[model samples]
Target: MTKTRIMIALVVLLAGLKSNGQEALFGGQEIVSPEINKDKSVTFRLLAPAADSVFITGDFLPTTKMKTPMGEMDAPGKKLLSKNGEGLWTYTTEPLASELYNYSFIVDGMTVRDPNNPFVIRDVSSLTNIFIIGGGKADNYKVNDVPHGTVAKRWYDSPGLGMDRRITIYTPPGYEDSKEEYPVLYLLHGAGGDEEAWMDLGRTSQIIDNLIAEGKAQPMIIAMPNGNVTQDAAPGMGSDGFYKPVFMAPKTMDGTYEANFMDIIKFVENNYRVKANKENRAIAGLSMGGFHSFHISRYYPNTFDYVGLFSAAIMPREDATGEVYNNINETLEQQYKNGLELYYIAIGKTDFLYKANQDLKKQLDEIGMPYEYVETDGGHIWRNWRIYLTDFAPKLFK
Candidate 1:
């Protein structure tokens, strides 16, 4: 098991596997599934000969009558994939709008990915193959010839949580050459999400780069941190391979996440060259992360001027306090009176948490809280979250 012996053994094993054709295993098959065509339409193919049936699932399809948000849309309720003589099942989608989409193959009722496509992203919420439809608003997600930003997987010590945790940071294109301080955006992930959630599925870096390049958004640093309270770090960095002290899961009944959040702020301010003030700070989150934003901005009204919530999981008026945000409508009024810049809330009309958002809106309106509300077509999926980021990032520090 010495280092050299292990390497040689691995090389020998890999060579033996490739010796049959010598190149097939290394280069992959000649077929490419989930091919994005120049016309914006996409072709998906799977070589699942043993599968009795196959179906394709992704954001490209409408979200109607789709049992679960992750379920592939098949009108008349299901899309029966077509089988070919080569034991390949195929499905081609109509021209799709430009955006990042998640998809997967359903083979005989089991979920699988396109063997031919290597680009895949996963989180607690969903796992699927991702493809980009180039055009329109999606241009922000596409990789253009713009000056790109740098993304770092950074770790900071949290005394409050008594552990080391990770956060993904994105510095805009000119950050390295310039010593000027930049604004900070504390982007949080939802339940079952780690620091990598936004970095992976949300396409945070690409969107920020495109926005800054187009002069739509300021050159700012985005810090995406793990929002789980009970878990000191994300899955791979944790002692249990996931959040533990099982009761500490942020989503669990115990309420402790918001209490320890200052460690994150302090970590950023101390380590990064950021303008640590309300005018130069923004905070946003999706789902559970949204709930965090609503409270964090409310509790510490002077902290972030810009707040965004995408498909937020807000509590009803009654349960909004005690375990959650400090139960005080007066605090909310104070938040508005304290020079809050942008209190933006966005949700899909079809989202399961739509009613919660409605209640939050009602509370905000009753309190005369000046905030912006955006409603898109889909549910609590990454597409809407990405759209929220695309729009919200540009509106910051203006």
Candidate 2:
């Protein structure tokens, strides 16, 4: 064979080797390196099969329903580029000031993961790639040698609800060292979750231990309660109707959470060695827990000095009625003037609750209520809530 033919054969062999032994090609798409610039802008490229819409979705960007529409692509400081025949899509985003973000792709209305990024986090059954930027106070939220807190599973009977409920509580590292009374943060679990959700999945104790040891966060007791309100929604609900009736309601407003949640708080304060005053008391939760926080704190403003809602499900003005609305309006007005010390609302950009949170912020803004609104990365996942607690706890009792 001639030299040219030999060279052609060699090139074909190399291509065959790469195709057979190397990369796993899924829909012929591979994510290239994602680069973060000094301006905090992130530029990432993905090689994929030519499709109608190859939109990039992440914690920084809104979740697109159908990939092709790419509605409102002109997000401030965002740019998209695609090659004609190569099927390479590149995206450049504005400087994201968050510490962590999770994202995925929408191809023709179907959500898919980035093949290149190895760091993926699971949200229920779906998975998304995560990217972190601008490391903030949450850098110290790992397990450490500081006086570690202990997580215990405690059971309780709710007479009003006529059910036996279980709860998880975390005692600060030095609870046994001295008889000093500590403030307590009543954390609530979200929909489709149970009492042990915060400790088992959210890692409340570990985060607290690390934060307290580093002195970045205060050492306090955290009580995590089951936020499910349906009588059949305890851990082993056999029927689907008992799963999430609140979410399925006509307006998605939970009317049953207020009474049961208050009972749990009363139980914690009365039984535990917690400070009884509002200044030393707080309430916070995620998703459904967030709904509980907003409802509980607004109803019983004098009972808590700090209120945090992570991706809270704020009830619409039309939905609020009866005692719930009257209490929320009165309490919000009073708290706005008296100052609750801390009123925080945090949600991820890609989360479905982001727009709702923004709407709630707007309402608070209209009322001149003083509260912190944080937009971070990742959807409605425990990872985002864990980070929120880490940042939020230190700001309390200070």
Candidate 3:
């Protein structure tokens, strides 16, 4: 063939390629990675040219049954993926409830973030992509136009813990200027969490701000302290780093937390302009934190008038021995006599700790302790905790 004819044919082919919208490699048309449908269903897509299998995991999907510190349990949701001829993998979820969910992609057995989704959150260990299904309960998870609070990472001297520890503080709107002393909530984190837990995964600021704006909650200071008794901070940055394994910290924490408990209270009381009164002080935690809140409030019965326990790690059959129960019941009786305002206990009906909470309630009933019990829908996940906080905070200092 002549050179001129070949060149003309190549030009025609190039023009056809450009006009046909045929991409060079694998991408051509606009691909929306995660498209939230009007019906609240979510469609996720990923482009992988060389992948054998792809799977997606999130709270929106049920995970395999696995053993936890509480006991052996199975998760709630699960999802699989399908591939198309264009090397694009896709999966669509059924209509999920209105809530905040974190998800990740597993491409050929290698876990990865959603390359197409830019919104991601860093939990204790790894980064997970996140999406919000906006509606009823989920609305609290978002940042609204209402006045927001400030979350500060501050370090304080914990002579009780024998080291300087870090804590996250959230001062509500108008706190800096308001000469009025505000009520304080001593919020604590669960196991494997840090001072950043409530502020990060729990959506502390967003919830508090939105509630305060809507008049659902009074403006109060929330002090979230790390609850790892053995460790100083989170997994890292502590005297006991991640290298040091802490299993069932609730069972193993002899008296370090109790011994150092007053130190944290002192730190918060002295640093913040909180009203130093029993009615103005509240203590609450989830899971291991719930365990801590249960004990700490009892240890100093008259200290905190308001107590909240979300999925508390209460072991009545084991931890609540005869002697312990006798002492705790005595304190419980004293707190009741001293006019305890609110003794709130909350846990998901399906939580692994559900049986434990029930046992604790039985003991409470036997001791004639009057407390409020809230049973939610889901298990021991953050959804319940966040909702518990949203519900519990409004009832504070009222």
Candidate 4:
């Protein structure tokens, strides 16, 4: 080859190598000159792996709803470059929104973490890169000098599950000051969640603090527990055919969890100045927690007066089967007459459990059970759950 030809070939090879190079651990792909256009269009380029398809899944796109037909991430707009032999790929697309969004890349049926972005967030499954399009409400999450609840990490022995577990409890402000008894709310978490799920991911304490300070919610003790009933049911049970942590199932029952939860309640009442009565106690949760709240409050009617279900997994009477059929009616009847004071059920419009929660409302109506049903924006996510707790707390123990 001539000198000019050789120089051109070398430059081309170097560019190819640069594009196909292995990305750093914290940097997966780059969105070259990501910008919001004058036409209200946001555009960016994605550098991906070779021989792979890249789909941009984020909150801005309606096609990204969870568990829907169009939810699967597919290649966006056009392919910027073919996957080189070195396993590198790149693409670009223009989305409609400029707001901050949470997204991920689905490469060959596996969700790969974003390497280019330093901000990482975790759901039940894996961590993904977080991107902010337009600036958001950062002041909302900042911890102010407001009176905050004290979080206690306590350990308890569970005879039901045959294991010792740890739980986190948040004592509301002035819990130690007044000798007067206070009410308690037991907040349960969903599958693949732990005791810290509410405090860490849901930010339940902050929501409660803000609501109570604003006089929108009453000050109450929030007891968050590890809701798993079996050894295999705890968080991090992947690769066991159960991709997500299993919810309440008959096959996984251990008698000790409910008893242990009660023990915690009793302990709180005895150790602290709590009301310690059914009228002052409440139980609520999301997903698996919702199922637990429904089942536990139903079975132990004398324990809790207020019950809230956020994106509950329990189906309606028409769709009930086996164990659900046997207990739902009885549970509804008990909740209607004497067991519960206020039964609250709320689910997001886009949540997968929306239809199920709606069916549950219908079942409650058919059985003459009284309840407050609410549907809101967002899905079965922390944003909704946090808002659920914020809205649900003021109505308790009033």
Give the TM-score of each candidate: 0.86, 0.63, 0.86, 0.68
Clashes of 3: 5
State which candidate, 2 or 3, has the greater TM-score. 3
Model 2 C-alpha lDDT per residue in residues 1-398, reported as the tens digit of each score: 99999999999876866664324543333345477778888877666655677667665764434321212212211124464565667778888774556677666667777666776754333467767674554344445456778777777667766776677888888787878888999997776565666765566777788878878777788988766544333333323433322323232244566745667877777777877888998899888778878887877667788999997766454555646556566678876666688899999887777888888888788888888878886566666888788879899887
List, in order, the clash count of every candidate structure: 0, 0, 5, 11
- In model 2, residue pairs whose N, Cα or C atoms come closer than 3 Å (at least 3 residues apart or on different chains), thus clashing, are none
Worst 10 residues of 4 by lDDT: 69-78
Instruction: For candidate 4, give the lDDT of residue 246.
Output: 32
Write the residue-wise lDDT of candidate 3 on 169-223 in tens digits: 9999988777878889999887767787898789999999999999999999998
Range of the 10 consecutive residues with the lowest summed lDDT in candidate 2: 68-77
Query: lDDT for model 2, on a 0 to 1 scale?
Result: 0.69
Q: Write the number of the candidate with greater lDDT, choosing between 1 and 3.
A: 3
Clash number for candidate 4: 11
TM-score of 1: 0.86
User: Which prediction has the highest lDDT against the true structure?
Assistant: 3
Cα lDDT of candidate 1 equals 0.79
